[model samples]
Target: MTLRLGYGTNGLTDLRLDDALGLLADLGYDGVGLTLDHMHLDPLAPDLGARTRQVARRLAGLGLGVTVETGARYVLDPRRKHGPSLLDPDPDGRAARTALLVRAVEVAADLGAHAVHCFSGITPPDTAPDTAWQRLTGALAPVLEAADRAGVPLAVEPEPGHLLSALADFHHLRTLLGDPEPLGLTLDIGHCQCLEPASPADCVKEAGPWLRHVQIEDMRRGVHEHLPFGDGEIDFPPVLEALASTGYDGLTVVELPRHSHAGPELARTSLDFLRRAAATTNGAAPC
Candidate 1:
């Protein structure tokens, strides 16, 4: 299977969706990790069917595949950054979060996207650990059900400072959910490096069976900054080799929102880097 290369719209947050697609196409990406938000195609907006069709047609024109991501800050709470989480104190607030994710799943179904990238929000500051997990799983059940009905996979991403912070945490989450088919992992390589002692390559191998989506970015050993290619401590060659060995036929999204101003340049550089890395691993000449 070919490795699918894509970029996150988080990096192109300033550009219109059409322009972002055109720029990504021109830069030679095969897919996009479209982060659903207000400025871009707001998945919560009215006339979602028409909007989905429009986006699908545009992506088709560009020959781009998509994976929907739901990490938009403040989408649920205007006054808080990632507030009203799935584990919120208020039951109504948690339901609101679930409804938002259900909406995202419907949008993903409409676009024929491969999967939806989701995350467990930060635990409320004062809640007990057991209570937090209970609330989180309880909040996630409805979204998982909706995704099952829509025939879409939900990839739960482990973030640096969130409720689910590592592969081990993800394993715990999977066990808590009691069903692996509807819930899978979105392995963000940078986060793994920051939070775990294992190398990114080793993490990929360890999490091989559970990985449904992947994100790549450079980061230092103990920090979570999403750096551009070659700017951090990650050894891309071995990481690519590990992915190749797994025969993972999924999107490897380049997520560097900080470099959004250099979107075109970053996209070109990242794609070229991946091509060369893959070619070297396969004993083929780089383009």
Candidate 2:
């Protein structure tokens, strides 16, 4: 079994998009986790189609794969990070969130990305759980259709403090989504370490069928902060081994969103650490 390694551009927010991709390719990474944000391939930018095509060419020339991501900190609302989410009380706000996701799907298709990762936002203080669930499902309707039409997967991640914060929450969403093949899971190994009842490896095993994308980082149990490998408590070898055992062919991306201050250094470090971890599992180098 093999796993391709990539790094998230959100972590490289300081670099130009081309420079970020070039740096990752030069580091021998197999792909990129491309985050759509105001500064990097903004989904709301005019001439987005042309920009996407250009990005596709650059990636092809670099011999790198990509996965689209929609977790930009303040893309939707400049003042509030991740505001106007799918569960927003106002119908227009929910519609806008859905539109952003649909645009993500369109970009994924254009870039030949394997998946588009997104999340359920925090539930509004005044909303009931059932109402939040309904709102989420309704908002996803068009996004799902766009994903299905584009032949790209919509991989919903379970964020630590968001509305859907666990593997079980993803399961519930799958049920609500009618288990569409294009609707899948973006399994963040660090998130499992932080909040899951099961070990990260076990979570990988259980999410095998639905897993479409992956994000990797290290974190202490019950702590939501993303940490560098040795600084955290996760036993990575077994977790990586479990992903390989499941025949997951997509990129297992390094997602250090807060490490952009030292982006280049951290990117190099992560690849080396992940390579050693993968070597422990298979006695061979990972891509």
Collision count for each candidate, in order: 0, 0
Question: For model 2, how does the per-residue alpha-carbon lDDT over 172-222 read when each residue is reduced to its tens digit?
Answer: 999988888789999999999999999999999999999999999999999
The global C-alpha lDDT for each of the candidates, from Candidate 1 onward, is: 0.86, 0.93
Question: lDDT value for candidate 2?
Answer: 0.93
Q: Report lDDT (Cα) of residue 52, candidate 2.
A: 94
Identify the runs in model 2 with alpha carbons over 4 angstroms from their true place: 283-285
lDDT of 1 by residue, 201-280 (tens): 89998888878789998888888899988888887777777876776777889999788888878888888887887776
Against the true structure, candidate 1 reaches a TM-score of: 0.96
lDDT of 1 at 117: 91
Q: Which window of 10 residues has the lowest lDDT sum in candidate 2?
A: 278-287
